[model samples]
Target: MSKSDNLNLPIYDNRGKPLELAYHVTYTLRLKNGYILALKPGEHIVRMPNLLATDVKRRA
Candidate 1:
């Protein structure tokens, strides 16, 4: 996607890998129950030291 495109949508990496709009840069993901996630534009990756949010990602 272009830099002007909406950031809420899913995107692909340089490797053509599909990535959900991550708190940080796009990467592989493994989901768990009770974990929530959202992709917002930011320089920092949102880390949930505790899974308080419904969105979360683990290693794939």
Candidate 2:
């Protein structure tokens, strides 16, 4: 299966509410355009909306 089709991760919102909970693989890489590319990892947690908690994880 393609990468996009194989994405299975848990995506939660600011309220810790599950948005898309599943399993997938993620990777972070620096692009030449000065942009960050994040590839969701398998069984990862991807939160949305208020990304306060998500930003905290990135700092660590």
Candidate 3:
């Protein structure tokens, strides 16, 4: 996976990998107990941190 903001996102597994649209990343994951387990470098489906949200653009 290329190094980018997507690297920070979490995923469900580290096998097939998944993708995050906003962050433009990919990762593999497995859902467990309403939580995601396992992770891959390119994945970015996980919720971002509050601190990271600082960059989010506000709606008009």
Candidate 4:
């Protein structure tokens, strides 16, 4: 996928509200699955393949 394709993913706020624009994107990381993770002032947004699935496992 291209950079422009990555930008097509929908962004959401911390409260789960869809956002039209994401300003001051402090950091961006590309996930192994080709999704982009974007972080702003108050929250981090990522486009996952399964929104309802819990992908992260905590290590103790």
lDDT of each: 0.37, 0.39, 0.42, 0.42
Tens-digit per-residue lDDT, 1-60, candidate 2: 645655333444323443443356344332222223344444333433444344565448
lDDT of 3 by residue, 1-60 (tens): 877554344333433233343355444555643334555576444553332233233212
Best candidate according to TM-score: 4
TM-score attained by model 2 = 0.22
Q: Write the per-residue lDDT of candidate 4 for residues 1-60, one digit (tens) a residue.
A: 646533555444443444455455454433333233444565554444442233243112
Give each model a TM-score.
0.22, 0.22, 0.24, 0.30
Candidate 4 overall lDDT versus native: 0.42
Clashes of 3: 11
What number of clashing residue pairs does each candidate have, in the order they appear? 5, 14, 11, 0
| Model 4 TM-score relative to the real fold | 0.30
Q: Report the candidate with higher TM-score, 1 versus 4.
A: 4
